[model samples]
Target: MTTNPERTIPPTTAGERAMLESWLDFHRETLARKCVGLDDKRLREASAPPSALTLLGLVRHMAEVERHWFRRVLAGEQEAGRIYYDEADKDGDFRVSESDTWEEAHATWQAEIARARENAAGRSLDDLSAGGHRDIESFNLRWIYVHMIEEYARHNGHADLIRERIDGATGF
Candidate 1:
């Protein structure tokens, strides 16, 4: 299937909102563009031992990662369900059920990213919330930005290897 091109930064002066948006768009685009052309088998194929680092799994996991931080933590929405929380201890996102298809994984991820983009649209950098009164003192917004980059970077690394294993494709 044809994929949309990478998301671009909105033209603006260098500011905190722009920087946050750039990072968010960068990671989402990285995953979508990097996983292009992978077939169902390749998307679900396990990369190594212990855990399945399939591109499909990464997509699902990244969607959860985005929702966990953006909706649950930052927005203080306590009702958001954990991704695959219904599967007990097993990594259901990575397990790839008999009915699980590449299209399902891709659609789920894209929907989550779209939700996150909507969430980002209504906020500014200076708007601050302390998240909670627990021992952690960092700002809520900072955690959101950092976690997005960290989750994307880790899974994108998995995508790189998974792509290479699929057909010798490589690059960021």
Candidate 2:
């Protein structure tokens, strides 16, 4: 089994925000580490029939997710359009095409991550969303951080299985 080096979250950390950010970063690297050494074709391969998931698709979907939560909702950019979703096809992020290369997907995901960090920087965990859509008016920065960490954790589990299936690699 091949081993990939991943960023480790400190077992014990100071402050809630620091701990949350550290774990989120670790999970982000974990997903990227899963895709390491895979070519575009391999990254685009699905685990089994009927599921449209792929490492490339997950990367794209995460990019869309980061943009939605950090930029659109938390930062109050309601006019911003989704990075991958479409009214006609809501699952465009997961429905990646042959034309979507791993390079593009990974780069977009990285960019979104950077933007999310920038948006959250200097803001308190107690900071609330500037605005939100109907019904849900606002959310605290802490909620966004926790939600993102949870999202990444769930998706990283999928990534683990997918990576293992791809190359028999396990335990990064």
What TM-scores do the predictions have?
0.81, 0.93
Candidate 2 lDDT by residue in tens digits, 1-172: 1346468674594789889899889999899888888888889999877787898899999999999899998898877688888999899999877798987888889999999999999999989998775589899999999999999999999999888889998876
- Each candidate's clash count: 0, 0
- Provide the overall lDDT of each model, using Cα atoms, as 2-decimal numbers: 0.70, 0.88
Output the TM-score of candidate 2.
Answer: 0.93
lDDT score at residue 150, model 1, on the 0-100 scale: 80
lDDT of 1 by residue, 1-172 (tens): 4565566654567676676678767778888877777677767887877666777777877877777666665665657777653547556655675566768777777777777776656666544542432455335565577668787878788788877887887875
Off by over 4 Å in 1: 7-13, 128-138
Scored by lDDT, the top model is 2
lDDT of 1: 0.70
User: 139 in model 1: Cα distance from truth in Å?
Assistant: 3.8
